[model samples]
Target chain A: MIKIDQLSKVFQTSNQSIQAVDHIDLQINKGEIFGMIGYSGAGKSTFIRLINRLEEPSAGSVLIDDQDITKLSKRDLRISRQEIGMIFQHFNLLWSRTVRENIAFPLEIAGLSKTERSERVDQLIQLVGLTGREDAYPAQLSGGQKQRVGIARALANNPKVLLCDEATSALDPETTDSILSLLVDINEKLGLTIILITHEMHVIQKICHNVAVMEDGRIVEQGSVLDVFSHPKQPVTKKFVEQVMGKPDNEVADDIFIQQVNSGKVLKLQFIGESTNQAFISQVAKKYDVELNILQGNIKQTQAGAYGSLYIQVTGTDEVVSQAIAYMDSTSIEVEVVAND
Target chain B: MTDLFPNVDWPDLMIATGETFYMTIVALIGALILGLLLGLLLYLTSPGGLWQNKYIHIITATFVNVFRAIPFAILIFLLFPVTIFLFGTFRGTTPAIPALIVGTAPFYGRLVEIALREIDKGVVEAAQAMGAKTSTIIFKVLLKESIPALVSGLTVTSIALVGYTAIAGMIGAGGLGDYAYFYGFTRRNFDIVFVCTVLIVIIVFIFQFIGDWMTKRLDKR
Candidate 1:
């Protein structure tokens, strides 16, 4: 478990001090994929680095599994460093060494014997699905292959906590999906707690159990994937969700719904969590004797469950319309009245 | 065929060749070691470098600039007293060691600085993220990864050292340059000067060739 308490980082430039990470506190549980999503320069990277002591926090303590690593000596810190592995967007593999040797670098530094180091290197090379490329150099490999080497190298010592610094940012979309799946596989098989930092919400929605949205060095919102996706409180979080789910324009949706429901009352519905079941949408319409016309609708599945948003027109009398919306509210679905056309 | 070269002694030519080889080899090794360490220091202590001492950088930079600006020939004459005191005479290859090392150390120091600067900063940050201490990052990552570039830089600087050795030879240090200056310049032995010039060219080409091969071999990344 990683706990950050009132952490802040201020870098003093020649002219003025810049607050890279403002006062923030967070707790990341063990064996879970925790994501920090934000735009560029939102202090997500700084927060992650603070957990690993890569960037010293100007204030507060970083407690990893009960040890306050912030105050440790440099020597002791190095020993602690062996436990937390990190991968980067650029891969950053040593160009001078072969993939095998690159993976074995940290193990060698930790004083593993040559035979032990080679065995560990081979194991990681297999784990990352680069078993045949161990002898190749970073220069000889493609971008995805190099990042695989980086992942393999980071896992050389079998760290419990893996920090991914925009690990998929440099890969193509197809490659990004493959890598994300690999990370998910590793997280499940080894129960390694992953702290993922990225600006892409799809990355979070795909694998993250919990996510935090950050802006200007502060976390604006955080919760389970379902909570943030179903009800985004912050504009930044809303924008991020729309980027992934492609929210239809409010004006267009309203006009189209008005046209469809010109004869009867209509309502906009938001289905979250367990309410994503088809039974709720279909059963409600059949029971009320109302024809359902979906104007704009989208459903996204997350770690928690499926969440959906839809504006549906229903040909029902005023009393039936009120009853239909009232019945839907008892479930996890939220029903709101659209203006009569 | 022997008329223009009748005064040439084959044994003396062989001895002069050996002298030039010794002078250039010894000075090149010393200069490389000195310059590489100095360069590492300059890199590690620059702004945002590992240690990050602006004062140390200024002082070191001033010393390097001072030495680098000095003409090698004039510096050799100026060091005559110390050369004599150190070697018991201001003549021969032994006296030339001080001048040669002094002249080449700063030159190679500056070269090593440039080579080290050319390395990507991302590599350094990656090492740091892994919890590598400063020393490990330098010797293990920076120096090891940059070996190919460093080797090439050394090759260029060492070839320049060969030229320095000739200047040392001009100052009574027995080598190809001494033979050329004495037997060819004073005695007007055009054949001896031509042979010495050819030897210098061949030695430089050989060093340059080895340097290039080593660089290529190590540049597999």
Candidate 2:
């Protein structure tokens, strides 16, 4: 478990001071994948670096398994850092070293024997699925392959907490999915507590069990992936949620067909967890005397469960449509009347 | 060839060629080691570097710049006392080495710093995050990553050292430069001067070829 208490980082410049990471507290449980999502300059990068003391906090403590890393002496901090591995967005592998040598780097720092380093490096190569490219330099590998080497190198020391600083932001969509799945595999196989910062809601929706939305050096909101996806409170959170949930409400309202709805009403329906699995749209249409047309809908799966939204046009008597909206409200689905005449 | 250059003493020319080779190789080795150390210090003490000490950076930078600014001929005369103190004389190929190394190391040191600076800062940060010590980062990350640049820098520095050696020879140090001066130019034996120039050019080319080959072989990037 990692507990960050009132962590703050203020970068002092010649002219002024900038608070890159404001006072924030977060608790991540063991064997859980926690993600922090924010736009650029939202302090997500500094926040992750603060966990491993890569960016020293101005005030507060980072307790990993009950040990305050910030308080450790330089030598002791290095010793502690061995168990808190980190990977970067640019895949900061040593270009001069081959994959095998790169994976053995941390072990070499930890003073492992030559034979022991090789044995552990081989296992790590297989774990990250870079089995055959052990002798290849980082330049010889593709972007995904380079990240796999980064991941393998990070996991070489068997760290209890793995910190990823925008680890997948540089890869393409296909490679992103592969890397995310590999992270999930590492989390399950090793039970390592993984904390990653990213701007992509798809990343959070896919693998993060819990997510914290950051804005201007503070976490605006945080919750289970499903809950956050279904009900976003802050405007910033809503924008990130819309990344995977489809167009925003204002954009949907501006749709030509939605504007042409003279008599019918446009409703935005949100489905959470098992409710997404139910045929709520079909049942709602049948239960009420209404013709439902799904204008735009997106369903995404999260580690907690699946949550999605649909923008539908329902044509029926106003009373019956209101009743249908009330019915959806009574279920796990949340409904909003986007347009009504 | 013998008929064409009747004034040329074969044994004397051979000895001069040997002295030139001796001076270039020994001074190159000294300059490489000393310059690498100085360069590492300069780099590590610069702003945003690993050590990042202002005073140390200024001191090292001042030392390097001062040495680099001095002309090789004047530098030999300036270091005459120190050369005699070390070598017990200032009139042979061995004494000339001190001036050659001092003149060339600072120049090479600047190149080393530039080469090190070209490395990705992210790679250094990555090494630090891995619990690597300062020494480990220097050897494994900084130096290892900049091998090709270092080798090329050495190649340029070695060529400069060759030129400095000839300058050192102009005063009292014995080498092809001294031979060309005494027997070729002063005695009007232009053939000896031409022969010396050819040998020096050949030495420079050899260094260039070896440096380029090693750099290409080491650089996987």
Candidate 3:
């Protein structure tokens, strides 16, 4: 578990000061995947670095498992840092060291003996799925393999919290998915609290249980991933939600069905969780004698459950359409009539 | 062979070669340790370094620059008092070592600093994020990462040190330079000077070969 309180960082230049991270407070639960999504210069990187004091905070405190990290002395901070593992976007591996030696580096810092380090490193290599390439240098491996070494090295000490600063930003899409899955696997197996900052919404949608949308160094919105996806409140949050959801209204409006519809209503249906699995459209059509025309729809899976939106044109007598709308509104599905001609 | 170089003394030339080896090897070891420490200090105290201190950086930079700028010939005469204070005399190979180290350590220090600076900043941050102590980062990360550059830099410094030892020999330290200057050049024994030049060239070649081999072997990147 991690609790950040009023964390701030201001970089002073020769003639001006840049506030990289403003006063921000956040709480991340244990064994949960918490994601911070923001564009570049949104202070997400600085925010993550402040958690480990890699970038010393200008103000505020970070509490990890109830221990105030900001107040610790230098010696104590090093000891505490062993319990907080961090991985970088560049996979900052020691090129001079082999995979085995790189993974054993943190164990060496933690004062583990040779045998203990070897045994732990072997297990970690297996956990991250980097088995046969133990003797290879970082340059000899692919981008994904390099990131695996970075993960194996970070997890060597069995830290309580894993901080990932754009951990997969440098990887291709396929590699990024693999690394994200590995992070999920690690979180599940170790019950480690994961705090990752990324600009990709897919990463949050794939593995994160909770999502926070940041703007101008402030967290403008935070909630369960499903809630944020289904009902995005802030403009930035909506933009990110649209990253996965597509531009819904524009796409549906461009459809020929919506353009040619004369009578009846073009309804936009929002489905969340269990509603996506039900036969609401069929049931409404069968009961009310209305022709159901599904123009376009997108269904996506989140950590919580399924979330989707559908655009459908209902054509029938006015009385029957009203009855069908009333019947659908009674169910869990949300019905919005976009056009009534 | 005897007719070709009647003035050349075989035994004395061998002894002179041995003396050159002794001075170069000892001075090199001394410079390696001292320069490494100085370079680490310069790097660690530099801006955005692990221990960023403008004052320590400026002072160390000044010291390195001052010693590095002084000509090696003048450096020997300038360090005459230090040589005498340390060795109780300034007229032999051992006394020549003090000046040799003092003159070359700063030059080697600048090279070491450059080698350290060539290391990726992200790697150092990775080590620090791993909870490594400053000592561990210096020894394990910074030193280990820059071995190739450090070795190559040392090769250049060692070659320069060989030349410095010859200059020292011209003063009072007994080596091939002394043999060449006293027994060959000054005494009109061109054969002795020519042979000494050949031996020094061989020594330089050996150093360069070893340095290149080690650098190639150690550098995985």
Candidate 4:
């Protein structure tokens, strides 16, 4: 478990001081994939680095497995860092070293014997699916393959925590999917506590059990994947959630829904998990005598479960439409009145 | 043929050529070691560097700049006293070693600094992230990554050293340049001067060819 308490980092320049990270506190349980999502320069990178002590914190402490990492002596810090492995977006593998050698680096640093180091490297190479490319240099590999080497190198020491710094930001869409899957596989097989920082909502939707949305050095919102996706309180979080759900222009959606129905109401219905499979919309329409026209819908299976968003135009007497919305709300679905006359 | 080249003393020319090679090789080895150490210091002390120190960086940088600005021809004459004090005599090829090193070490030091700077910052950060100590990062990451570029820099410094070794001839240092200046120019022996110039060009081409080949072999990027 990693617990960060009131952690902060401030950069003091000659002309001005920049608060790269405010006093933020967070806890990541063991064997869980926690994601921090934010735009560029939003302090997510600094927060992750603080956890590993890559960037010294200006305030607060990071406790890993009950040990105060911030207070560790220089010698102890070096030894403790062996347990925290990190991978980079650029796949910072040594261009001069082969895949086998790159994977053996941490082991060598830890003073492992030659035979043990080689054995560990072979296992990591197999684990990361780089068996045949063991002798290839980083330059010879594609972006995806390079990341695989990065993963293999990071895992060579069997670290308890793995920090991925925009690990897929440099890859193409197809390659990104493959790497994400690989991360998921590793998370399950080894139960490694993984903390990944990214700007893409899809990355969080795909693998993160919990996520934190950061804006301007502060966590604006954070919760489980289902909770945040189903109900985003912050605008930044809402924008990110909508991005993956194929956001429709609110004005256009309102105009189109209003044009279709001269009165009544237009509502957006959110269905998640088991509720998505249920015929909630049709049931509400039938029970309340409201005619429902579905304008747009998007549903995807997230790490939590099935999640969906639907825009519907409910046309009937105001009393009946209100009754229908109330009925929908009584069920597990979330109902919001977007447009009404 | 004998009449055309009457002033060409084969033994003296050969001896001068051998001394030139000895002085150039010894001085180059010393300069390379000093330059590499100073260069590493310069890089590690620069702002945002691994072991950044403002004061050390300024002092080292200023020293490198001052030395780099001095012309090799004048530098030899300026070092005459130090050379005599160190070697007990400032006249022969042996006394030229200090001047040759003083001239070329800073040149190579600057080249080393440039070569080290070319390494990606990400690579260094990755090493540090792995809990590598500063020394390990310097040798294993910084120096290892910049080998090809360093070799190319070494080649350039060496060629420059060859040029300086010739300039040492102005202070009674024996070499092809000394033979050319004293025998060929003073006695009007154009054949000797022409032969010495051709030998210097050949040596430089050889260094260039070897350096390029080594760099190509070492560079995987």
| Minimal lDDT window, size 10, model 1 chain A | A248-257
**Model 2 C-alpha lDDT per residue in residues B3-100, reported as the tens digit of each score:** 88777888998998889889988998999999999999999999988899999999999999999888888898899899889988899999899888
- B100-139: candidate 4 lDDT, tens digit per residue: 8878888888888999999999888887777788888888
What is the per-residue lDDT of model 3 for residues A1-341, given as tens digits with 9 covering 90 to 100?
78899999999999999999899999999999999999999999999999999999999989998999999999999999999999999999998999999999999999999999999999999999999999999989999999999999999999999999999999999999999999999998999999999999999998999999889988999999989988899998989988998885656666777778887799988778643654777778679889888877888877777788888889999989999998888877788988888
Q: Model 4 reaches what TM-score against the true structure?
A: 0.89
Candidate 2 C-alpha lDDT tens digits along A12-84: 9999999988899999999999999999999999998888787888999999999999899989888888898
- True C-alpha contacts between chains kept, each model in order: 0.60, 0.70, 0.82, 0.65
Every model's DockQ:
0.59, 0.73, 0.78, 0.62
lDDT of 4: 0.87
Ranking by lDDT: 3, 2, 4, 1
RMSD of each: 3.1, 3.0, 2.8, 3.9
Q: List residue ranges in candidate 3 displaced over 4 A.
A: A260-267, A274-294, A312-331, A336-341
Docking level for model 4: medium
lDDT of 1 by residue, A106-170 (tens): 88778899999988887888899997888898899988888888888777778879999999999
Clashing pairs in 3: none
TM-score of every candidate: 0.90, 0.92, 0.92, 0.89
lDDT of 1: 0.85
Instruction: Find the 10 residues in a row with the least total lDDT in model 2 chain B.
Output: B164-173
**Candidate 2 stretches greater than 4 Å from native:** A249-269, A275-295, A311-341
Pairs clashing within candidate 4: none
lDDT (CA) for every model shown?
0.85, 0.89, 0.92, 0.87
What is the docking quality class of candidate 1? medium
